[model samples]
Target: MSRISNGQLVIAFLACRLSSEMITIPGEMVSYGFDRFAVILFAKLIAALLYLPVIFITLKFKGDSVITAAFRRNRAFGITAGIIMSVLLSATAVQTVLSVQRYVTDTLLNNIVTISGIAVITASAVYGAVKGLSAVTRSSVFAAAVFGLLIFLIGVTMWDKVEPDYLYFSFINDRSHFLKTLISEISMNSEILIFAVITDELRSKPYKTVIYYLPILLILMEFLNMLYNLILGPYMTKVEYPLYIIASLSDIVLFQRLDGIDAIVWLMCGIIKAALLIYCIGRIYTVCSNKPHTTLAVAVSGFLIFMLCVILGSDAGVYERMTKIMNSGIHILLGGVVVPLVVLIAGRTKQRGRVKKNDENI
Candidate 1:
């Protein structure tokens, strides 16, 4: 398989990293009160700014995966970072399985095929991971296009339901709660940095050029959040999946219900997301073992994911608890603190090595 271009990298990052989860943002935002939209947006904007330095550092080690960069730069730090990331990614994959399963059962299959949902999702994810990044990239590119069309169609269909006035005037009533929720959103979205390790596979572009992609993604997410909040109103806070509710309300001449379409699109997006996480785990495992068989690494990682899905399938609550912990706890530690520290330490180490090399040459 050919290496992915920078364009593909962006698509993969956007599609695999971002999803209908943005639909839940409005629901989460409403909990802080409809007044919090501005606060959440501002908070997300700040978080995006903070991500800049990490992105720059990631690009500096573009050719190497994060695991490789860490180990080559600092063995101890790299191993520690790997363990932290592995736990988070594994937990995320399991959660993705549960989310997709529950969504499918509730929205599409009417709970009849609920138990089989996780199995189906796990199989699809494992297939993509085993096929390698090239396959994953191709799938993500296609999925991104389809996802865009779906979002556009939904926006048009729901145009009348949107209360621009409410969204425009909304403000967060509780400053502390708004700040806490904003931090959570940042932690969740910032996992895209995991892809930075493979940035070398992308086409080389100006540093600032990559930064431009951030706003586009953020805008799309913000729009989705706003739409959900407007349609569901305060009731959004009670809805587990606001996007599903929004999709259900969609009606056209031929289709009375669009929830199925949204569910399918989200299911595909979840597959891509899970595959990427599995790929990261595989790469980390390979790097740690110093193994040359990327194929074997992918298989082993895929097996683990499949096993986890099966184990978590019987108790949906367990999956939710695991995700709550990872999303709230591990994501904060890894994305908010551990990763930035690693980048700083790696940057300093690289500089020192360069100076030493220059002195030796002199």
Candidate 2:
């Protein structure tokens, strides 16, 4: 497959991150309100620092995922890397499915038999995964356009509702609260793992993925936070889905309200994210198994995610699984930071040994 364009990679990942944020509306982020501005700023900085290992590893092993590169050097190391990423990414896919289920149930379907919703989402995800990353990223352009129009509509109709008075300023007084919120914000960024694993090889200017992504995400999130604080003000706390409420406020024609369109756009983004995850899983499978059985891999990955969603159901069970994963921060740190760090260190140590041998021979 041809390399994924950097623009496509950036937009696709951005949509996934933004969609996840909109659906999640992290309690810490909502709770902190205006004060979250500082937390977000600091969190992005911390995230940038954490991303260095993966970024530099790409420079060393260009055109390969860390696992692929490691596997080339040491089969055992690559297998270990593959296993860790496979587990984490599979969990990530499940989390995406569960989130999509919750979003569609609470907003779009608002009915029973939520399993049907999971079926549709996972099924579409499989199709996208089968199409491969290039096709998936291309579809992201369409999803992004839909999201952009939604934002425009929201801005046009809801601007007057955004009372400057709704905004307020106060630092979080509790040190523990601030730290916890910071960690939560940091952990929510599973997109980094996607970039680390895939985009490094795809983007010609690999680091720009982070450069183009973080600020855009931070700005978009801050804008949404501002909307929550500005439009809903104190009343925002009462609603489970503030984005739904924001959409409901817009008086669009045909649909008569934007909430339905809001759901569709979010659903599209969710499917796109799930597809990306499944595709990555397939790629990892190819690396581990040493066969280009991408089609089989995608099928199996989709099946696995579908089974997980079915088994988990669509209630407190899914919620608890996702919550534990997010709260722990281990998945993000290990996959996004530690694994790449290992690759970087191993690569450098090997390079130095080569240099020593060359000098000694002289």
Candidate 3:
């Protein structure tokens, strides 16, 4: 396998990690009011800054996968952290697959398909995971390009619907509600830490260079949040698939309808995201297990994920309930425990030099 650059890692992280799920930001902000978008943005910025020190410490430890680093420092603590993260990643894959299925059913399919969409999504994810990191990263680049084009096309078509005044109004009636909603938005994007665990061989770049990229990411997120609010407003809460709403609103001279195309784009993104999660879990299993055949571990992990999707049921109601449960649970585990524990253990072990070497073999 060839080395992956930090730049490529960053791009792959952004592509697979970021999604149109920000479409939900407007609805999430409804109780907080429009100004809450700014507040949420600021909170995310602070969260990112807080995360930077941990990332720096992880790098200092020679880029150990968070689990391995924790394990090296304390076996018992490491195993607990690993179990929590593995379950969280698995739950996220199921939730994301179900969400995509729900979006397709409500916007494009009209409930015509009888077979399970979860199965199809799981199969695609397994295929990607089997191909390994190179395949996953390449697919991310291609998917990101396709999504970018779709976003540009939709923007051009909906240029006339833009309203500057949408920024002036507040969405929340009370200050406490606004703060709570802002925290929720931060929690939603906390998945970034999952990527941090796998990223061991980043391109050599100055700290300042990496820090400079944050503004660009935050600006794009803010713009997308504002765009959805301006176009959908209160009506946005009623629609489960706000990106599809944006797609439906587009009408160019040659291509009058693009909701089908949008659905295809979403399906591809969903597959990439699911595959990455599986890959993360597979990596964790490989590190923790003493098994001779790592491929068997991967297969077993895939099978468990498949069962999870099936048990959850591939419907809108099931999807919503499962999301509420998984999101809340995972956020607490990640923010409340895993990150802090990893940092604390790594500090005590002084195992920074051995982490990179151990990670390379695993």
Q: Which candidate wins on TM-score?
A: 2
By lDDT rank, best first, the candidates go 2, 1, 3
Provide the global lDDT of candidate 3 against the true structure: 0.64
TM-scores, each model vs. reference: 0.84, 0.94, 0.83
Name model 3 segments beyond 4 Å from true. Answer: 20-25, 74-77, 112-115, 201-213, 290-293, 314-319, 327-343, 346-362
What is the alpha-carbon lDDT for the whole of candidate 1?
Answer: 0.67
Candidates' lDDT values, in order? 0.67, 0.80, 0.64
Tens digit of per-residue lDDT, candidate 2, span 74-108: 88888889889988888888888888888888886
TM-score order, best first, reads 2, 1, 3
* Residue pairs in collision within model 1: 5-203, 6-202, 6-203, 35-171, 35-172, 36-171, 36-172
- The model with the greatest lDDT is 2
Q: Which residue runs of candidate 1 sit more than 4 Å off their true CA positions?
A: 20-28, 32-36, 49-53, 59-63, 74-80, 112-115, 205-210, 335-337, 343-347, 350-362
Report RMSD (Å) for each prediction in the order shown.
Answer: 3.3, 1.9, 5.4
Indicate the residue-level lDDT of 165 in model 3. 64
Once model 2 is optimally superposed onto the true structure by TM-score, how far is the C-alpha of residue 280 displaced, in angstroms? 0.4
